[model samples]
Target: MTTSPPEPGLHEGEFHGGDLDAARRRFPNAPAPWIDLSTGINPHAYPVPDLDTSLWGRLPQASDERALAEAACKRYGAARPDMLVAAPGTQTLIQLLPRLLPQGDVAVLSPTYSEHARAWRREGHTVREVSDLDEIGTAKALVIVNPNNPTGRVLPVERLRALAADLEARDGVLVVDEAFIDAMEGSASLVPQLPPSAIVLRSFGKMYGLPGLRLGFAVARPEIAARLRDNLGPWAVPVPALQVGAAALNDDAWLQRTRVTLEESGDRLERLLKGCGCEIVGRTPLFCLIAHDDAGTLALALGEAGLYVRQFPEHPRWLRFGLPGEEAAWGRLEKVLRPQGQ
Candidate 1:
């Protein structure tokens, strides 16, 4: 894995995956050819077709944007194309949402993505981290990451809709981040039943394995989406990203096959982690969260062997393992972890 510096503007305790430089600095003696399973991104990326040279020579057209939105709406089950606001990525939208909405108390489901809390707090909103959705009482805004990152906890759609209704009655809003939901079958998304007070964020990178393309969407009432679109300006997503994303979203055949592959890969990952004496706690099709008495130690051990897994400092017993992309990567993980089970 090539090394790069930590991303600029990262808050304390907001470390992300895919920081190979940090891994290298910490484990200098580790061998080359690092197996990076730190991020829950698909190792197999969608095949982006060759783009026309005109895509580069000219500014992205309004028609191209419309096509991309239409494709995303179809893929994500949004009510209409206008309901979706294309952005550079969900991370950008996450940072902008608190600013777009009225300032008030914001409750984020805890032990999940830290950015939701950080973004709200950054926007001067009173932030509360709650473990249960029922505990979110009276907050003006509620944020949830469905099939949550690192932990992989999934909240039922029925309960989420009920909460949205309750919040809407009080003039509040519910923001759902469905970044990992793409790989899960029969998962409920808020986009199809988008209430005026509910906003849903969808990621194009994780399931498609093209995080570099930096494409994502925000599905909500047209008014809210319009505001987000305005904030993002006229040409938020690059032309190449629009072309690649539109084609990938419209490819139903590839989506179906990839879903099955991710499920099988997830099962294989779960078994490998279990075999290493890690107790499985939660999982999604792209990753597994396992518990161990000394997760930090295990993470370091794996890192020193040129295998990088994710560890949460706040949750010392937890470690997250993303699916390996290739057979060699899986074999390397198993080889390094086998001694732990003994």
Candidate 2:
């Protein structure tokens, strides 16, 4: 495991969806159209409820947070009131965790989110990788991304609970970033378990396709949650985000339909990628990590043909593909894979 964190700062053409904003600006007239396969956001977004600006124009009030918290608990079956803390996005909560924990060493599961290690190291903590929980030792904190980003490796819930226990024994915090769990069949969300030293981060941006709204939440013991709230300050969630986010979370029929669509689309993507001679590593309900020695080149080729896939700079050999929304997208992608000299 690399004791030092990987290079920080965005690299050129690194395909996280948010990069599209810059891509569009740079390539005002790229030959082919751009299709974003970078971010693991659901292509189909939930229907945003009619916005009542008056209800949300001001900064989020305490009553508003309480209402949203209740909705989340009811939706995710959070058993306790102290378990959830809403944030502007899960990214914000994640960046804050290391700062909130007592000064000590930090261990992050590698080939995971770069931000986890980056955030810890940025705070002057020694960040290391843990392939398994045992490697965490008596560190100040252990961070794991359930259905880990890019890799899409979903750690079994039992293993996670055990790992949390190990960290707890050392009086350390266990932070589980469950950004993709909502797309899973049975999520291993720690939302219901608000253990004193455990924190779980959930993102509404990914599944709900409301990244523009910037909404997410943290689940921790009330005391920890209170500290996070105090540190992060009041009005963390804006009124528009709170109003629309609450409405979106309450839509059961939409949730069911979206889940079905994601499963089917994910299956199609996996099959298509396999047929293309790419090595499939692991996958969740949302995306899959694939490896080819020439992933960067292949991504460029796909981009030239109008598909924009994500490439991790550290692992140039691996790429992450978001589910293509329509068969036409896959058809075009497949067409690019045919033998050139045939």
Candidate 3:
């Protein structure tokens, strides 16, 4: 399917992935159609069911929410469906968690998602971005993005269990953003026995290739889940999101096939990057990080060639590439990259 492109603009400070609608304005000289490889969203989206007109006419029903939650629990391997809180998206939960959860000196695993730290700070909490667990000394709360974005580093579940235990003792919560963990084979998920003080976030859109659906989940103890659900109020997730999310989650065959395809594509991307003299610094099946001294210039060149990849200004040496998602896109990327070997 030919997917619509994400809005484009300078990603200098805030997230430049989905919000920018001014791509033509920023890259005036570039071609009309832009290929966006900036976000880790799966390019091959789940086939959306032809939603009934009544879905649009009426407000969402409670039964619809329950069904979606049930599907999510089965999909996520969670025994406690009561612990699931369906929200507009994980981004909404990210911002809301800070206000609802206990306040403490928060430590986020650094060089990961910018939103985690930003959310806490906006709520008047002191947030520290730390690379080492030991560096998080005396910090009551901790946040980590598993199979971390940009750099696909994963911390083992046992270590996180220990951290959760420690935080629970201190009355602080351990927030694990497993947004990209769905496609991971033998995923190190902290579910089935999610610690009393631990809250795990799951993204429905990334693995299923339906980010536009704006569906995501937060799993925690019933108490935390209740707080999040109540605060989000009634009909937080729309009828459309609920329908598609349920359908996709139950489609195990699609999940299995997509994982295999993404892995193959990820390997192909690695080889392509290597041929262009880029060091494959980090990766998950969804994205690859290229380490080159002049990554900024390389990114600019790719952008000028009408491909939008993600670049972290703070980490100028790294550029993250999502899958091209089509044969033509692969050809275009190869064409642009072959000429400019790092």
Error of 2 at 113 (Å): 0.6
Candidate 2 lDDT by residue in tens digits, 13-45 = 222354765555544564455677778888888
- Residues 1-342, candidate 3, lDDT per residue (tens digit)? 222222335453565564335555656788646888878888888899898878878788989999999999998888778999999999999999999756679999988888999999999889999998998887888999998986999999999999999988878899999999998888489876688989999999899888888989999989889999989999899998999999999999988999999999999999999888899889998999888777767777777778888877677677889998889889889999998774
Q: Candidate 2: which stretches are off by over 4 Å?
A: 1-17, 21-33, 326-328, 338-342
Compared with the true structure, the alpha-carbon lDDT of candidate 1 equals 0.87
TM-score for candidate 1:
0.95
Candidate 3 Cα misplacement greater than 4 A, ranges: 1-8, 19-22
Cα-based TM-score, every candidate? 0.95, 0.89, 0.95
The local lDDT score (0 to 100) that residue 264 gets in candidate 1 is: 91
Compare the candidates by lDDT and give the number of the best one: 1
CA RMSD (A), model 2: 4.2
